[model samples]
Target: MSLRDRLKETRAKASDGFRGGKLMSSIFRPGSPFRKGYVDSPRNRSYVVMNNVLYHLHPVKVKRHGVRLSYTLCLGGLSFFLFIVLTITGIWLMFYFRPTELAYVDIQNLQTTIAFGSLVRNMHRWGAHLMVLVVFLHMSRVFYHGAYKAPREFNWVIGVILLLLTLLLSFTGYLLPWDQLAIWAVTVGGNMAGYVPVVGAQVKFGLFAGLEATTATLLRFYVLHVLFFPFIIVIFMAVHFWRVRKDGGISGPL
Candidate 1:
């Protein structure tokens, strides 16, 4: 037998299930419209076919009606918009401010000397606040809707973790300005860490790097706020959204 013929015979003999069994794999029917050639149009029908064939990660049919503006607008879309705004404004603010003892001084200089710098800082601050609010609302909406059921329970757990991370992100940023508000907020927050059982002292020491919120504390929080949290949140958010799509789109109230 030829090499190609031998290979085909080997595959045919191996297992019937190898053809994609009924019990396994959500297989689309061969020659169905979904599997057929695309409709030819003037603009890029070939490209559409290519994309559909190449990227089959997303489901062929999303429940378009199930995805409502009322459910998604403030919860998902607004929060994502605020995240984008924070990322842009934060990067712009970075050009002028150093994450050092001079950090507060740089901010002061920006407010007094730099054009529209105060506005930039205010927008970042307010956006941070709004992100928190919207995230909380999102969580509540998901919870009330019973979206945590069955296959989506794990993703709901991830969403809860992301919520905590958002709060941590806000708390870390709170210390960056080094104003009285920032100082006292970190002090109180650090003290709360010390209130935890068993390894509380260790956690508090690690957070503050000794007795007080020193230069070390400022630098730690800065690194976390600007660098660490953003990276972590981005990854988690991507997973969260993917899982949403996977769990058959966002759930409606039970």
Candidate 2:
């Protein structure tokens, strides 16, 4: 046989060796999709989806239009990817940050003293900004495509909640730098919150903890930025994803 044929034969033999081995069988039960497209029946589909978390995130079958990049632009995926990037970069940044009266000093040190600290901090900051924009675009795409209608309405609501939570997460993180701009932004945001009707004063007080921004306000925002908001957003994102799958996988072009 020719060299090409020999290489193909060798590849086939190696594939078969694993494909027919006990390890493969142990990892993928009979009729598993991982086993040569065995998920051709309802029973196999259910079994594979139950066993595989990757399959659980996506539909067993998708329409040709639904898989088109032009139609969806993969905005949701991009948004999720940015969030993960932020999470990782944010964790790395936490080691150098101190959310106290010395917060600005810590930020200065982070940008100058540590290795790649400037790069990581910029990634965290820009990643947050990108996530917010991408999420908004994702929502807009859903609306333009009319994917927000009918059975997916509830998921749409969940998406809106996630958006709000994302914005709040960004806002909370904004104050961690503790510069003049951050303080001024907090004052403006607090003032804006005070316009809310019944609980306006209480809301403003809770936000800043007093008449003006203080170290306590920084601490509160830090806790919310690093802990509270992330926890809440993660829960909502899970529910949003589950509801999307239940609502009929990804919506196809109309």
Clashing pairs in 1: none
Could you tell me the lDDT of residue 142 within candidate 2? 96
Against the reference, the lDDT scores of all candidates come to 0.80, 0.88
Q: RMSD, model 2, all Cα superposed?
A: 3.7
**Location of the lowest summed lDDT over 10 successive residues in candidate 2:** 30-39
At residue 198, give the lDDT of candidate 1: 98
Tens digits of per-residue lDDT for model 2 on 65-134?
8888898899998988898999999999999888888899999998889999999999999999999999
Clashing pairs in 2: none
Q: Candidate 2 at residue 19, lDDT? A: 77
Runs in model 2 lying further than 4 Å from the true structure: 1-51
| Model 2 residue 140 lDDT score | 97
Superposed by TM-score, candidate 2 places the C-alpha of residue 42 at a distance from the truth, in angstroms, of 14
